[model samples]
Every structure is written in C-alpha cells, then in structure tokens.
Target: MVLQRLLLALINRAQLVERLAESKAIRRAAQLTAFAVIKGRLAGKQASARLRDSDTARMMREEARRMPQSAADAAQTVSRIRNTFMKEVKEGMREANRQIKDRK
Candidate 1:
C-alpha cells in the first residue's frame, strides 16, 4: 500500500513536470542557466591558459639569466685547475735540480 502511494505521487509529479516544461519562461531560464555555465567555463579556461603562459615566460627568463653566470663559473674553474697544474710542474722541476746537484 505504501509503495502504491509513492508511485502515484511520482506519476502526478511527472505529469506536472511535463506541463511546466511547455512554458516559455521555463525554457528561457534553462537557456540562461546553460549560457552562464558555459561563460564560467570559458573564463576559467582563459585564466588557466594565461597562468601557464606566464609561468613558461618566467622560466625562460630565469634560464636566460643563468646562462652567462654558469659559463663564467666554468671558465673560473678551468683557470684554477690550470694554475694548480703549473705550480706542481715547477715544484717537481726544482726537486729534480736539487737531486742532480747532490749527485754531482
């Protein structure tokens, strides 16, 4: 008996819904709601795209600034290594000279 009442109520509600659907005002409201949803989605997409573009630009700029500094650092490291090697060669030459003089 309870199930029968619920089914009857749903049938009545469905009939009322059909009648309401035929009204121009209801149709207009639905169209407006759809447009609002579409507009909101479009705005969100545009903002997300802009944020991605800005982030890419910032990253490119940072890379550009780092290039020269990294090159300079590499050059400085090479110069230090060369200086150390030359000093070692000179010290070895002096030790060799001392040994030769003592042998003579």
Candidate 2:
C-alpha cells in the first residue's frame, strides 16, 4: 500500500509539472504574439513616415523653385512649410498611436 501511495504521488507530481510547462508555453506564445503585433505596428508607422517625408520633400523642392529672390523671404517660406509638414506628421502619428492602442 505504501508503494502504491508513492506511485500515485509521483504521478500527481508529474502531472503538475506537465501543467506548469504547458502554462509557460502558453505565456511564451502570448508574449511572442504581442511582440509580433507591436513590431508590425512599428513597421507600418515607419513606412508611413517615410512616405510622408518623401511627399514633404517633394513639396518643399517645388516650393523652393518658386521661392522669392530675397534670402530672408525664402527662409521664412521654407520654415513655414516645414512647420506645417511637421505638424501634420505629428497629428498622423498621434492617430496611428491611437489606432494601435485600440487594437491592443
């Protein structure tokens, strides 16, 4: 009877260990999934930023071609354009962040 009790105890311990390992695997999977999601979001954000930057650069170049002859006037125009572009980019990033958070 004692030997039988020992065997039963060992079986229970083995089952507990298995359960623990399974839980760990589940947790790891969840973590990996979260990482993947965040990574994807970051990649998307980077892509959008790149596209926006390219568009802004093109617009700036076009504006520069039409800029006034005076250095001060040209500088002011470029600064204004840059400020507007940056403001739009910031708003876009905020919106993206909100969407990402909502997804989570």
**Leading candidate by TM-score:** 1
Q: Give lDDT: candidate 1, residue 41.
A: 100
User: What TM-score, computed on C-alpha atoms, does each candidate reach?
Assistant: 0.44, 0.42
Q: What does the lDDT read for residue 66 in candidate 1? A: 59
> 45-95, model 1: which lDDT tens digit per residue?
986775565534454455456554577776765565566556656775897
Candidate 2 per-residue lDDT, tens place, 1-104, comes to 99999878876897776786679787798799999999999999998787767657667887868958799987888788788789778987999999999999
Query: In terms of TM-score, how similar is model 1 to the real structure?
Result: 0.44
Worst 10 residues of 2 by lDDT: 50-59
Best by lDDT: 2
lDDT for every model? 0.73, 0.83
